[model samples]
Target chain A: MELFSIILLLVMGVATIGSAILALTTKKTDVAILAAGAISLFASIFFLVLASPDVAMTEAAIGAGLSTFLFFVILRKTEQNAEK
Target chain B: MLLSIENIALASGILLILIGLLGALTNKNIIRMIVAFSIFDTGVNILIVTFGYMPGRTAPIIDGAKVTAQNIAQVAIDPVPQALVLTAIVIGFGVTALMLVFALKMHEKRKSLDINDYTDLKW
Candidate 1:
């Protein structure tokens, strides 16, 4: 079980780093936003694996859901303003 | 030979912090920087949780049946970091939202997302 947990943790770490890199390097702001949110989601899972379910739920709800939606709203508003 | 889970978690947390710092530093766009900041925030939270972990320990919940007064500390992980992370997560969300609003207002005033463009306040 420890070995399995270690493997999962390593995998999650890689995924988190990969998504963060994508968020940084991506040209499109929307894609970057999504990738950033993915980092949060993955981190939430990491939190769960570390025996912190409360933090995991909070991360999922705020980091992935609320933050992503807020970013989208800001993006839309900015784009619309730019068009005008 | 495999490294211990604690070492693994710590290394990963450090890597995440470095990655976030790199992203935050290299990004030119306002929104991208804010996204990078969130990444950094998540890394910090992970580090805090990882630091609180104990090998072979369960969650910090107290059921009063399985986890009694005598063995609670031995069976459960630390709760302080979890509580700290909970507050940090909410605070991070609030700060990120405020940053996004600031970005919006900046765009409204300058019609650009590039941080370099906001040089009026710079000396």
Candidate 2:
């Protein structure tokens, strides 16, 4: 069980780090928002594997679900051509 | 086994903190930064739970069997982390909701989601 948890956590850690890097480097708002959501999901999984189910669920809901929705809503409301 | 478990827990906690800091520092998107902040919180919660674990312990809740003081102290898991995680969850919700509102307001004013475009306060 410990080994399984450790491996899951390491995988989650990599996914999170990758997503954060991608979120920063991506030029498109939609892509960045999606990356951010993905990172949140992975982080939530890490929380669960580390034995904090409550935090995992909250991160899944508020961080990944609602926040992503909010980002997309904002993205749709704003113009995408201002940066060029 | 005990030493390895402690090492794993420590590594996981450190990894979470590092990821959160990286997200906050490098990510310019407001939503991304919020997510990173939440990640950091989750890491700390995990650490709390990790401390609650013991080699041969039952759940924190008490039942009819073996409810003595020493048994309660020895066998029961710590309930503090569970409580702390609950509070963190509520706070995370409030912060996310506020961030959403701010994102909307910024959208209404600036007409763009790009952080670079919101340069009105820039000197």
Candidate 3:
């Protein structure tokens, strides 16, 4: 179990960094927002692996779910105004 | 040196913060900056949670027959960091919301996403 946990942490670290890079370098706001969501989701997994389930759930819900939804809504609204 | 779980998580969290700072510094678009800031916030929260982690302990919550008053001191990690991260998450959300609102207004006024386009405050 220790080995398994270590391996999972390493993989999650790589994935989190990849997503952060994508969020940083992407030109499209949509993709960037999604990447930010990915980062937080991976962090929540980190929390879970570290043995904090409640924090994991809150981070997943607020950081990943609500924040991403809010970003998309703002993007959509601005695009609509631009078209009008 | 041995690579423990905490060290690995700590490294990742610090790397994330650095990446977010780099993005925020180099990105000119307001929305992108907001995204970068959110990434930074997550990194900080990760660090906080990592700080609270114990080597062989689980969560602070008691469920079923696993954790009782007698064994909780031995089994559970600190609960303070969980609460700290929760507050930090809410504050981060508020900060992002405010930034987005500002970005939206700026975009509406300038019709441009680039930071260079805004020179009204330049002296």
Candidate 4:
């Protein structure tokens, strides 16, 4: 079980790093925001795998849902889609 | 090795931490940074819950039947994390609200959302 958990943890780590790299390197600000949100969503899944349902619920609700909504709201308002 | 619940929780906790770190460091927008803060908070919440779980444990409820003080004490899940998470949720909510307020204020001041545009203090 521990081994499996370790494997899952590794997978989660890879996803996190990948999304972070994308978020940082992406030229488009909107794409970066989306990647950032994806990282949060994956993190919530990681919380669920850890058997922390209460925390997982909060992560999914606030991290994934509300946070993403906030980012999208900003994106829409700013129209700052141009890459830097 | 057979999978167990403990392993599951541990995996999730680590994963959440990694993602939160990535989000915080990589995202550029101020609003996205605020969202990343919430994600990081969520990661902390996951760690708290992982601490609360005990193998072969039962709920802390007392029904006075098929549940005794010793039984509850010996196998009861830690209530500390649950309480901590509750407090964290409220605090996190407040922080998010404040972040929103700050974002709005900044936007109103600059009429811009780009973090790079705020260069008054920049060297």
Each candidate's interface RMSD (Å, one decimal) is 1.0, 3.6, 1.0, 4.6
- How much does each candidate deviate from the true structure in C-alpha RMSD? 1.4, 4.2, 1.3, 5.0
Worst 10 residues of 3 chain B by lDDT: B56-65
Expressed as tens digits, the lDDT of each residue in A1-84 for candidate 2 is 766666766666667766766765667657767886886687667556544566668778877797778767655655452432
Better by DockQ, candidate 4 or 2: 2
Writing each residue's lDDT as its tens digit, candidate 2 over B3-110 gives 454456666666767777777777677666665675576567556767766544555555668655557877666678767876876786677667767876786776
- Residue B40 C-alpha lDDT in model 4: 63
> In order, how many clashes per candidate?
0, 0, 0, 4
Model-by-model DockQ, in order = 0.81, 0.32, 0.81, 0.20
lDDT (10s digit) by residue, model 1, range A10-68: 88888888888888788899999999899899888888888889999999999999999
DockQ, prediction 3: 0.81
Candidate 2 Cα deviation (angstroms), residue B79 = 1.4
In candidate 4, the second chain superimposes onto the true chain B with a TM-score of 0.85
Q: Model 2 off-target regions past 4 Å?
A: A79-84, B1-6, B55-72, B114-123
Docking class of 1: high
Chain B TM-score, one value per candidate, order as shown: 0.91, 0.79, 0.93, 0.85
Q: What tens-digit string does per-residue lDDT give for candidate 4 at B1-123?
A: 334555554555565566567766766567666655655665567567767777655556566775577677775677777667867876776777677667767876777666788889987
Compute the DockQ of candidate 4.
0.20
Best by lDDT: 3
Candidate 1 CA-lDDT value: 0.89
B20-98: candidate 3 lDDT, tens digit per residue: 9999999998788889999999999999999999997888877758988788989999999998888888888888888
Query: Which regions of candidate 4 fall more than 4 Å away from where they truly are?
Result: A1-6, A80-84, B1-28, B53-70, B119-123
Single out the weakest 10-residue window by summed lDDT for candidate 2 chain A.
A75-84
lDDT-wise, the better of 3 and 4 is 3
Residue pairs clashing in model 3 are: none
Give each candidate's fraction of reference contacts reproduced.
0.80, 0.28, 0.76, 0.14
